[model samples]
Target chain A: MKIQVLFGTESGNAEIAAEDLAESIRNDNQEVEVHDLSSFSIAELQHDSLYVFLCSTYGEGELPNTALPFYADLSVVRPDLSGVRYAMFGLGDTFYKDTYGQGATKLDDKLTELGAQRTGEIGRYDASSWEPVGEGAVVWFAGVLEGVSATR
Target chain B: MDAPLSIAVIGSGPSGCYIAQSLRKALPQSEITIYDRLASPFGLVRYGVAADHQSTKSIQAQFSRLFERENVRFAGNIEVGRDISLAQLRSTHHIVVLAAGLSADRAMEVPGEGLPEVYRAGRLTRLFNAHPLEPTGVPTFGKSVAIIGGGNVSIDVLRLLIKQPEDFANSDIDDAMLAEYGQAPVSRVDLICRSTIANAPSDPVMLAELGRIRGVRFSCSDPIEVAEDAPRTALARAKAIGELLEVDPGPETRAEVVLHFGWAPVSINGDGHVRDVELRSVNDDRTNQRLGADSVVTAIGFDFDGGDWHGLGALKADSETGVLDQGLYRTGWIKRGSRGTIAENRSCAKTVADEIIADLDSLEQQSKPGYAGLPEEVRALAVDYAAWKRVDCAEKEAASEARTRRKFPSHEQMVAIAHNKLVESSAAQRGN
Candidate 1:
């Protein structure tokens, strides 16, 4: 399966996670492409392939600076992701008073709203606990693969 | 081997958290302790971000998870210079990450900067964030408010002054701050930009947000000259111009807050108090404008406040590259002047981290110690891992009870809570 990994990071953590995930997938003989969400256009979401979004929510549940324009575009109009299978891993803190992980949750909801099938349970990683890195991420990805395989 | 190298990270802000997380991922065996002058982690994320923008603040939850790592510890409410010294840190931790951010605002260089009403946007932001220094009383907005500068800071201040609770209630602003903001008689917020709209650093999101304001009108005209005698008129001219010129100042627009672009402040006209601000056109074309407002906020920018390490020869920074004398590492606003969004800081930080890692192999061969050995002063203040976690929990509980996000009103509160929690946990462990 051709897997495309897209990530948005404010301080590079999400990018690092995305890269690590892509590397792990590649090691398993799966073709993986990783792109920064800032560089990735909304149109690319329509590609006929499996997708994984590893995005970091920034100031006040907003998208990272690089992913803002794309987010803005998505917010206004829904894009078709009919056959695309996807999973979202959002990096955020729940400590903030407002809606915590609101940004990532918004994206996940929007993607699903546009008819994309969620391949796995949405992974919401809290940096406060540091439990979501390494093995945690690996296990989440494994579950996604299993789901995708079953669906196929 | 050898009890995994101990690393202490100072500041616990975004940069500090990122560094700690990266180090943990790179070397899981190493022990990491994140420290901050405040009792809570995530420095600016807790305070600097505007209250209405709760979405941005949500990122702090991610940092909290990083602290929960097996080998990572969070220490809050411990001032590095005061509680501990740089020399002390070197004795304990193998590596010390100084992610301390800029603590001071860049001066406007105008005479009336010391006036009561003239505030720094950074300071104002901290106040609204309920930072330790936030004044107790409502700020006197008078009839007009002139905010100098065209950056994100300026935009935020303008938003706060104009939008009121009806605009911000849905956002994450704290109750106390929102109540105070709602009571303030801030009819107009004039955003002063030294350059054209194209050159201004104000975010487009802010501009779009500003456009939505009902009672506030944004003007982009040259400020009127302030005469020695007619101090009030000079300030009122922008308002007057806004009322007459704006064909459609939007539906909620009433009080004119003229946004003056292309003017550099020359002086503040007053001896003891701020009465008027004398401004000159940037071209030195002799065109003058005097802005009369009760309060003036210089939102120019922020600058790094190098702590006790300022005069240390060991921390000497190269004039050109901004690298430290040891050359093992460098950093964000301190290394490359304050500018750029968080996204930009990522690339800069990555470059610095990469350079430090690249030299690690060569330095190990030469028997030179990496940043593992911090100065003694920093190590002294390092709180135990469990203590920091308690402080983090206390802040969360406090924020939740207040129906607001996490906020530690004072540094002392954080320290006390953390210390108590440490004691409680120790007692429980002993009983077990």
Candidate 2:
């Protein structure tokens, strides 16, 4: 399946993580494309067969600078995502108790509200830990592949 | 097989740590040495960030994790230009990354700057954070503190000065500084912005925080009025005066601090000691005001100290080439103008690093002895990567024991620790 990995990163951490995951996915014999959220558009996202969203929550649980406008449009415009299957990984520090991963959670909730199916549970990565649990990404990809195979 | 490439990074600040981390993961075999001017790492996080912002300071934990890698070494108290020269770095390592951040603050250049009470926000923040400069002594917060500027730094100072002990306890403020702040009889603080409230550079979070101050009242409408003997007032002064007028002081009570906006200091009235500040209205609008305060702090911003790098010739370069000098790179406030939040620097650094890496493969195609002209000073030093790691461990242990973040007290301490480690290693080598 063609997989699109889009990332919104502050300090380029989530972007690096997305690139690593994309490399892993491609190594598994699946086609993968990675794009920075700043350069990627909502309209372009419609073409992806499997969507993976990796984003970091910035100040006060706000979206990263590059993803702010896209997130704003996604929420108010209510774009249809009927054919989309996606999963989100939120990068944040647990120290911020009040607005923990609010950026990614909002996007995930919005996509689901727009009728998109969440392939698996959202992955929450505490940047304070500084380790990516690839198990979550692997399982989500497997689920997406299984769905595609069943449909075929 | 060829030997793995070795890289030396000067200044173990955020950019340096990030560069080392990226290099370690991308090129695992490559050896990395992170050299800092101080014994401790995490430059701005340890020095510049306000003590009250513990949530932001916690990001250093991630950096500490990156340094834990076997291939990475931390060299504390190694001043690049002084202890090690550019020529020496080129000879010892295949590549050298300069991630040293800006060290000095920009000046307001107004007439009253030389006044006894005049201070810079950068220095003030550093002093309160228990940075090496903190030992000098905390600044006395007079009856009224007028902070000039509406940026995050100004807001940070305001919050630190005005917030009570309970608010500060939840954060990681240094104990001594906290006590000093508590005893300071400063009651009124005036934040002066050049423009209207809407045009202020303060972030929404800071604005909200300012609004939440229980004992402090904010005035956006009132401006300061200039007395005949007072200095000229800027537009901000007009707004402050309007706000101050609205405030009702109880009988036998006065606002402890008055934040004067709009009036830029034209001259100092007193002889060597600052008696009063002469003010001028901004834009020559004729509306003037004078703040009759004993102390003043110019919170304009920071500028890069380019004097040291002047020998590098055209230190400036196109976005594609990193720095004009080969093997040299600039990032963060040093690369671009001082603007944007901390996260913006990541992209800036990445862009420069990518440019250097792109040229790397091509340069290696026509390879020669990389370090042909070694500087005499760098060649004489017996310091190595392993010795640096020992000093790093010692600093981290000390910080952990103190239940605080890592800190290098002085330049001398850092070098002494590193030198001792080098001697110990030599002794062990002979024994073995």
Candidate 3:
């Protein structure tokens, strides 16, 4: 299967996490493609493609600046993604209590509403803890790997 | 048009590196060259932060990777306002980012503020951290010291002064400065704030982390008086402080930190060196009190060193985008003022990078020679990444015997080392 990694970020944290995850999965001999959410094609939400969304919440738990277009289009177009399977990880600060990880949750909800099945639980990393997203993504990939195997 | 774009970043600090990192992602075909006035890179990481915070300095590991990129280069010892001109930068490179940071130290207009013993946080940090630009080897601050601010910089200064020399064994502190500070008569540091504790701008973690350092005792005066329109971040900080109050100081204390809230420095009273400061309460002016201290550090904050007097004055930084004007842009301190964590510069630089990426279509077509086109005088003086590595190796080598990481500690010596006149492993005589 061709794995797709999409990142949404204001500070490039999500993108770094995606790139690290994509490289690690590739080293395991799997084919992976990494993309910025702004450039990612929604039409690619088809069957037999594995997906991982690395996203960051900004501005009171809102979507990243570049991720807005994707969110708007995906929500409005509401593409049929019944065959799509994906996992998500969000970068947020706990100091932002009300909006913590809301961006990723919103996207996950929209994707699920569009008939996509999540491969595993969403991961949330806090800035106050000073956790580098790349470090968290590596551990989150294991659950994603299990989900992919079971579905296949 | 050539798909690859050439970029010039004026300052090799986190702000510059973050822009380079974002540009590599936003525009893959871009080539980034970082320039600094000093022979070293990683501006504040190398020279601004207190030396005791070694782990904080490790952020260089990530920045170092940016320099190794095939399309990236670090050019040091090149002054923009003097060695090169802003007009020259704009003519040669597609984008010019002024990440030089807030270079000027903001001093108060109060009387006697410029006394020999009084220092600003910016220059003091550079001096303690061993930046080549620091004027002298050791600044005299006899016995008691008073920092007139409640921010993290004040806290950092407090820790640097109160900590023992052995505490910096694994750090990159200047050996000479550390030894001087070690011998200084400094024993008590008073943090004078204009508002209550909650109103102070420093992170609560700063207050709680005192447990890690032995011999330092911290005592604050009342909770912060939360303002009606106090931002959410500050309110959150107050909540964090509520949590930090739970930590208890362990035994083996030596130095003491006394915090005076709701007090402002009215004037400095000193004949030659600092002797005393007259502090006035925030709510009332008549409530004047005098405190004795040999040294006073104005750890208030920093302002943009806008060289507007030069006609090419820098523009004000935008809240959302860092576009100063037309083709010229900015990031980091000069753009946003000296605030926010080091990591926050990533987002600030990313915003500036995105603006540049969007304007790429309208940018002037690729020019020949790029950085090589710099005037021969400036080009000859530029120190590339390889020379910086040698300087690094030399600094480490010099400190090897003391088992501490020492630095060139002076601009003249660093430039001399880059010119190959100073041996890497041997003690190079000080001065240019």
Candidate 4:
């Protein structure tokens, strides 16, 4: 199955995380492509590929600069994603308790509301943790991949 | 048609890197070189952000890619005004942008500020981050420390001093310095701010971290008012401070932190080292409290050192456009004074890049040699990106099991490592 690792970042952590996950997928002999959500079109959400959204929350739970246009297009166009299976991981600091990981949550909600099915549990990598994001992201995606395969 | 754009950016800090990133996107064929006096890149990320905040420092991975871009180079260990004159750089490059950030800490100017126990926030922070310029002496903070500013920097000091050794797992904090300071642990911290809680400039998220520090008791003299109509940030700050104030350290309490609002330092009292601090309430005419302190650290702010090597220190940029003069530019903390976060610098850089692009679009083409045009001796002094990478690898290789990397605390050591002289020096030491 083709996997799309889409990332939106303000300070580039999410992008780095997406790249790490893509490399991990490749190491497992799987095909993957990395996409920056800034230029990604809402209409590109197809049922054939599994989408993994890696997004970091900017100030007060807002989408990162690169993800803003994508999220806006998704909200306005409200594309039907009936057969789309997606996983999500948010990069955030737990110190921001109220708005922590809300960027990924917002995208997850929008996709679910538009009839897309989510696979496995939503993953999170806390910036406050001592664990490095690259390592933590790869570990999170392993579970996500297992769940996707089991569902298949 | 036009000569390929040649740009030289002074300082490899966030602002400089962001400017280079934007300019690379807009003018991919341009010659761009970022210079720093230190033999390293990512100025504050490598040295200013608290060592424990490794997540924030991870932004270097993005900036690191910028140094590897085609036609872009990093000229480390090169000081613009000292190694190569501003006039020389101008003659060599089509444009130069000064992002050399403010260097001097704004002095408290109170009597006894020069006491041995008194330190500036910038120096202390740099010291912990193992900045080569900062003295590596383990600062003595005997039991009580009084921080004289309300910014995030002050909180950073408080966190560093209060955190246990275990809290720094995988962090690149200077272990030797931390161990020496840990010998005489600071048990009390008095955070003094001239403004009210609502007006303190520290982010609420930063202040909120205080509540999470294990085994610390917090108290506030000023009432934390979360007014219904207060601004969201102010309200959040008040709530955080209020929550911290309610924390009960219990029987196993490790330390105590007291927050003082609406108070200004009158004097630091000590003969040689700090003994106590004198403070006055802004509302009252009478001189008020004297808290016994082992040391006093000021985090008021920063200002440029009087030597304006960048030649744009006059703040003469067109306020609306950010253009100083033809072929001259400024950005980052140096451009707008010492303020703003790294994220803000990215936007500021984009704006300046836009300005530079528009300005260059109108100018006539002229052949300009960028880094290659510099004198052989000056260029020889630079530790290029690859050499600096060697230093980086050496630092990581030298780390203990707990730390991510052990930074060279002196310029000599880093230079030696970068130039592959460490092996020879170690062999010499062994012979001795």
Native interface contacts kept by each candidate, as a fraction: 0.18, 0.35, 0.09, 0.32
Off by over 4 Å in 2: A1-5, A13-50, A59-62, A68-80, A92-102, A119-152, B1-4, B21-31, B133-135, B212-214, B221-263, B278-286, B313-321, B361-432
Model 4: per-residue Cα lDDT over A42-86, one tens digit each: 888888999999998886677887799998888898888899989
- How many backbone overlaps does candidate 3 show? 3
- C-alpha lDDT score of every prediction, in listed order: 0.66, 0.64, 0.77, 0.84
Superposed model 1: Cα runs more than 4 Å off: A1-152, B1-4, B133-138, B170-174, B177-182, B222-254, B284-286, B306-310, B313-322, B362-402, B421-432
TM-score of each: 0.70, 0.74, 0.78, 0.83
Residue A54 C-alpha lDDT in model 4: 93
Ranking by lDDT: 4, 3, 1, 2
Better of 1 and 4 by DockQ: 4
The reply for model 3, stretches above 4 Å from the true place, is A1-14, A27-152, B2-4, B223-252, B283-286, B304-310, B314-321, B366-368, B397-404, B412-432
- Considering every candidate listed, which one attains the maximal lDDT? 4
DockQ (Cα-based) for each candidate: 0.15, 0.30, 0.16, 0.30
Number of clashing residue pairs, candidate 4: 0
TM (B chain), model 4 = 0.92
Ranking by TM-score: 4, 3, 2, 1
- Model 3 RMSD in angstroms: 5.7
Model 1 sits at a Cα RMSD from the real structure of 9.4
Writing each residue's lDDT as its tens digit, candidate 4 over B4-29 gives 77899999989899898888889888
State which docking tier applies to candidate 3. incorrect
DockQ of 1: 0.15
Model 2: residue B124 alpha-carbon error in angstroms: 2.1
